[model samples]
Target: MKDTVMGTLSQRLEENQIQLNQLLGKSTDLVTKELQLDSSTHIALVYIDGLVDTQVLHNSILYSLQEGAIQDQFKDLDPFQKLELLRKRILIAGDLSVTHDFKQFVHQLMSGNVMVLVDGTADALRIGLPGWEDRNVSEPNSQSVVRGPMEGFTENMRTNTALIRRKIKDSQLWLETFQIGKVTQTSVSIMYLTHIASPDLVQEVKSRLGKIDTDSILESGYIEEFIQDKAATPFPTIYNSDRPDTIAAGILEGKVAILVDGTPFVLLVPTFFVSFFQSSEDYYQRSDISTLLRFIRFLSFFITLFAPSFYVAVTTYHQEMIPTSLVISLAAQRESVPFPAFVEALLMELTYEILREAGVRIPKNVGQAISIVGTLVIGQAAVSAGLISSAMVIIVSITAISSFVIPESGMAVAARIIRFALIGLAGFMGLYGILFGVFLIILHLASLRSFGMPYMSPIAPYRSSDLKDSIFRFPWPLLKTRPSNNKIQDLKRQDTSKREGSAYDREK
Candidate 1:
């Protein structure tokens, strides 16, 4: 615990703030250690530097002190009234503050505000100082869907929430705040629909969040693992996103969203396995186009999952299934490599992984000129250098690109990890091993549940109505009923019978 100071600056910093920073390993530069006192006013302007808007802060705090607004507000009213009115109207653009105590004042300043104090004043008035000190919103590099809203979430939590809020525009949308980490004390918000969302699910999510015991929460992934239901599965239970429309859609569908400060990724719980294939673009466009795109995504998904394994199986055990020409070409390509086909594939994969890591680790911001876009040349060079076979390079490149095509990056990573397992299985017993491995993966997915709803819903539980929206989307008019499992109250999507009858009469 930080030592609580009664009424002194030197005393407070020496006891509370320094100890707290040391405990937390916080940046000393962010902590504003300042002291100023006039004849009737002594003040401590403790704030996180760079986060405050200097112009607004100087206008509010220093200008108020010079103008004597603090003393003037206190002249007619009681001590409490002065603090309240000044903070309500004169200082804060709104009434976000409930108290004018030292602790509350400091907290507000840390969150971006200017604090004003007088020597004789009992409490401090926090001036509204919202700073625009963050990177501009940019296109999401990870979950880039071609036909959806181009806006993406940023590291700033408030900006991220605002982007989603713009999409929702409903009063029933609720945001509950909490601080998770002991030292970091990072801000986290849980967003959900109050009326439409399941009460049990909301409470369950809150219960899990409250149970977390951690010193710092730096990313949504940290909260994801802590709150997730355990069954020793490698696949992620939480759906992580960098798009606000996707999160807003999730909130509308009765899922709880967790947004942590300082990371673009947000976590949505009770996410179905089908959601990994679904994109924000799926809902924004015409139903026919949506259906076609959805089907293509599904094909890409299965291709990513089974392509390498199928290739291995056909080359090794199921050689009869391959065309004679392909076999001759692949055989000719592999003849130079002393290693087996499987070994060659493994070597290429490892080499690609190293190059991918190198690309990320070499920070472009720090003047590193290395670009991964020349990957084709690198692969060609590798083959020419006799480090890998041409067939292996092609296979590795295709697999990597296929994995990228999966909309949900978490699932893409899951596919990558599972692909390796499938490769191992294929190398062992070819077709049989590959089948056994895929079967296990399917079984695991079927058994997994998100907030008591099976991960593979509509397929595992078999709901025909929900299937219209899942796997492959059907025509919007044909989807006359809401997804049954979603349990939406406004279920009648369209009057399909009336439309069909009118169309028949017109034709006649």
Candidate 2:
């Protein structure tokens, strides 16, 4: 079959019977496929709402056709050479691209590339002019901070890739594209520094991606679970972020990043235990402030994971763990509540989770109002009604607030779920339960390997040099070497030891 250009996709779609419509995902973005077949012929066009540049398609192909389009002379060119020539000389007709595979052609079309099909042609002409309106780069909503690069990943993959390219201008930086998802045909980009990345890890990731047998992949989360090292683990084996700077940093550190179309968040593989405790701001701020913040985040993470368990163990089985005055206060508070410690904690946790879930699912403008009202109504109203003690309210509130301190929201969420199991254990065996839970968690973390690198990384292997970047912020100059745990062969990042935390801080 031959590829043809038409003024209108409707021209190829005889009878003007081309069909188009949006997709069924919960997201409001537009996606559609149009099929124009009459009696015996068949052709289709697909495009994502904002992703396809229809004007470009019209101007390039339609204008060329109306003006008696001239086809490039690639008579001696092979298919590959012909494709390249079309891209270079012919289809420079604006943003039009040409493709061969029917499935891939449809995929491109859905992604906002216009498709042109002529009668009796086996191949389709796929045009590239993605014009999807994306939000301008801004600070990540979940990872907002006063310091750090304000640029965030946009939903558009091209824009997201550009952001990283701007950060690391090395020619070794590589971006490999693959169309994942059997039906959804989502575009995923695997990026890494060619010289620094481990070949084994790259192969492993590619193999895992090739094995993903899913009909749809809406976001990086879908790709994460499908390619996760383990199926049933509370810990997140893959790291994800909405910040371009974060992904760029990961890439520089010999880590690989996965960028999926249709989502702003990208995936970082072989993430170490220390990464979850880190914030993008840590690298942007003064080392003293960064270290302090890191310490606080670590402390807050423990509070999120152990606070309720600590409370339950002390109040229920180990009253001796509580001070005498505190014990009396707890007793007084519980006297008015009709539930046992386990029941009370469970009820409050479930309530908080429900409130949080509802808050997020609600409309954007109303989400904050719902959260405020829900918290006030649940905590204050329950306290006034003597249904829950004010002390328990405070404990739950503290736990929720602490959870937010974790820079990685996905890991924080996993920790929150596991906290309940820890609480149950604590209620049964007092401090022993907490210790047992922590022991298991630590063991699991130590045993876990992400693309052959230990999940605990510098801690598990115990590299003193790499420790400079873990759990504490060392001066940028001091971190002259890459983390040995990343398994990057050329591990030296820089040799300049003449550096303080910041120029401003030093001047002060």
TM-score versus the correct structure, for each prediction: 0.83, 0.82
Question: On a 0 to 100 scale, what is the lDDT of residue 256 in model 1?
Answer: 80
User: What do the candidate models score in CA lDDT, each in turn?
Assistant: 0.71, 0.75
Error of 1 at 455 (Å): 0.5
Give the true-structure RMSD of model 1: 4.6
lDDT of 2 by residue, 394-466 (tens): 8888888888789888789888889999989987888899999999998888888776788887888788988
Residue 63 lDDT in model 2?
A: 58
Candidate achieving the largest lDDT: 2
Q: Model 1 over residues 1-508: C-alpha lDDT tens digits?
A: 2545223322232344463355346665454434442342334455566767777667655565456445544455643554465556555542344333444444665667655543334555555566756889999867777787898999999899999999989999999999888657789999998876777788888898899988889988888888888648877778989999989878876678999999999998787888888888888788778878777777777777777777777787888887899889888876666777677666666666666667668765631222234455676787787766787767776776766667887787788778788888998889999889978998899889776767787888888778888887775566666565655445665665567666534553
